[model samples]
Target: MTCPPPTATLRPGQLRDPFRLLMDVTARHDGLVRLGRGPLGVYIVSHPDYIRRILVTHSGNYIKGPLMKPFRTALGNGLVTSEGELWKRQRRLMQPAFHVRQLQLMESVIVAAVDRAVDRWAAAAETGRPVDFLDDCIELNVEIVLGALFSTSIDPARAQRLRELTSEVFAGLASKVWTFFLPSWFPLPGVIRYRRAVAALDAEVHALIAERRAAESTPEDLLGLLLDTVDAETGAHMSDQQLRDEIFTLFMSGYETTATGLTWAAYELARHPEIAAKLAAELDGATARPRPTFAELRSLEYGKRVIDEVLRLHPPFPIWFRSTVAADDLGPYHLPANAKIVLNPHMTHRDPAYWSDPETFDPDRFTVGRFGTEQRHAYYPFGKGSRMCIGERMSQTITQVALSAFTGTFEFSVAPGFEVVPQYVVTCQPKGGLPLILRRR
Candidate 1:
């Protein structure tokens, strides 16, 4: 699978600022463009067909590549990075927990978490202080994932520790272009931080796994389910290392993306008072609160559209990194074997070729008949293909529940000069917390 010679000259520059760099690069390139030098070599793929080739049609030609290894170091060979039969087996075992039907069982937990966060906002509203929506959403999503994934409650103190450690891991990983290429023994700050974070995370995970294993009675939560899961052919279950890996993967992938999406959705609503009012009206007409049940999510179509629109404009995982195992021709360009390929959903979601007024935040564009029937490659908030996010449905459910619960309880407005800048670590997140005033209706 030798790749064809490059058609366009690779550009060179010091990408001192990742956000500005990405915005500028995507603004010019029609589809795929090679940029940067050394191990930070970036190939931006914005075309729908090109994305399809990398993520779906011929996805096997790529593995998880350099971008994801820091996370892999922390999480081990779990579904997020494992390839071939290993990923398939783990994904199969984990898929049942995230099935559409199973999601209903987790709805109450999601609502409870949302309500907890909103209660704080309500308090803040009474005092006339702006609530940090981004921080609240991030914390809320973490609680939701922990509650739904494990039977027992996560100790708040321990959970806080994990959050700090996880943030450190992602922050360190985000700083460099090719931290993955550095040997694990390297004494650099990034390497040292990765090593320290890994040890801390491993210690926490092992303690939790041990506690769960020692419990005389096993229940139906994610931990118990993972314990019980066995491969059909090998009759083998996950090793301790594997268990830790999966849980860490779930924590990283499941929490950050959903949290970021929720933050953006809220930011959008805050920016447009009329839009928020319209959504609030829809919420008022659609369902009665305590909190809308998973069954009631279908009636919250407008809310779902808001989330979908957020995903389009500010996707959680913006640029996907994949290595070309075998080089093949992509449109007019010939990619060489082992070429570092980057699939840019950030640009594709806004591709003028596929979307009208691609820069606008129009939920109506995804009105019922629009989303499922639209071209698949044009929208990839959860990504595409075998390595696609396994927690997609669950994340959507959590977002819907959070939005419905929060919006039902209060009115939202962004604070003045509240700029939303995106920064990508393992996931794309708002650079600063989204500060917004929450007024009681």
Candidate 2:
């Protein structure tokens, strides 16, 4: 049997920057490239066909892989981290909450959250203070997610505290993914901090759950849906622990990913005033009121393309992993049982073979009627197949609404000499935050 393409061993310095290292390896090898040695073997799949095979066609041959293990402490068996029948059950129970029709019900709630942020940003713009654009996105997204889930707004102080803690916890989890050899049970300072952060986040989620249970009425929000959902097969409802885990998982997965997407949209728009102007024009023409309704959001074609391009350029979850359940042949390579595979959308989306002018920030690449068949699997920001993000529709709606509100009301320019570096923590975030000057339009 033909051996897989030779593994690209990492140099010591390359280990420090895995994203760059992976990019270099993908550029050097063909569609399939193996890395590392022994039981730690990794196959980095870059081609869309192989990606489709692994994530979709042959999905049952793999599972969530080892990379997601560390996140279990914080995420529990919630949809994002869980596997097997449990994942299916939770996904089914929570699926309706993200349906387009269901999300439309929360349109006013989303608008209210965005309005609150716009009010704050207007004040900042008036003062001529440079706002951390990414931080602002985070706050707005956190508020939006919480309000959507609970149908109530959280205290600003408490929301800020939860944001910091969740960031710490996820950063710790990302570090653990990179340093797989380090024992999480080692009780290092970072590990201790991660535990504390998880505990704090859990406390907040549990408190919300408790308050909801004791209240006289619960709105038909996500939390209420999860609490009310009963399994068709077993006729069982989620327990309090299950509810807490799912709620926290949904909050973390939904908020951070959406915020990251919006942040990158803002970053890209600020960098390209021409594109920003187009988006602003589309937003202005799409609505006469302060906020667009759900139908109006669908009409903002240019705005949607801008967001699609932003997600293509900077996917929040840049890397995904899956492990082989048994020895099998993949393309020209023969893989042994339990071999790890890495799917890098970051590399695939930028592959020159699929995207013209891959390095350029051109939203027109996503313009309707311009994309080709190959682009289907070439751009998977929210992933593909059965395990695709259940929150994809809601995220898109949240991002479209938030971006329209902010870009329509204000003009944003990056702070002079501010360099944007992509930091791959749990999510790819703009390093040092995105500082921008906002002027009310």
Q: Which candidate number has the best lDDT?
A: 2
TM of each candidate vs. truth: 0.92, 0.94
Q: Where is model 2 poorest over a 10-residue stretch in terms of lDDT?
A: 180-189
Which candidate should be chosen as best, given TM-score against the real structure?
2
lDDT of 2 by residue, 48-127 (tens): 88888888898888887565677778888888888888888888888778888788788888888899889989999999
RMSD of each: 2.6, 1.9
Off by over 4 Å in 2: 153-161, 181-188
Local lDDT at 26 for model 1? 70
* Local distance difference test scores for all models: 0.76, 0.82
Clashing pairs in 1: none
- What lDDT tens digits, residue by residue, belong to model 1 across residues 1-441? 334322333445534565557667777877877766555565777888888888888888877766566667666788877888888888888877777766766766777788788788889999988878878887888787777767454677887887787777656656643455455566665577777887887898888889888888876677777888887778898888889889888877775788888888888887777888888888888776746777777988788888889999988888777788887778877877777776778888888788889988999888756555444559998888777888888888888888877777788788777777777765677777888888888
Model 2, residue 368: distance off in Å is: 4.0
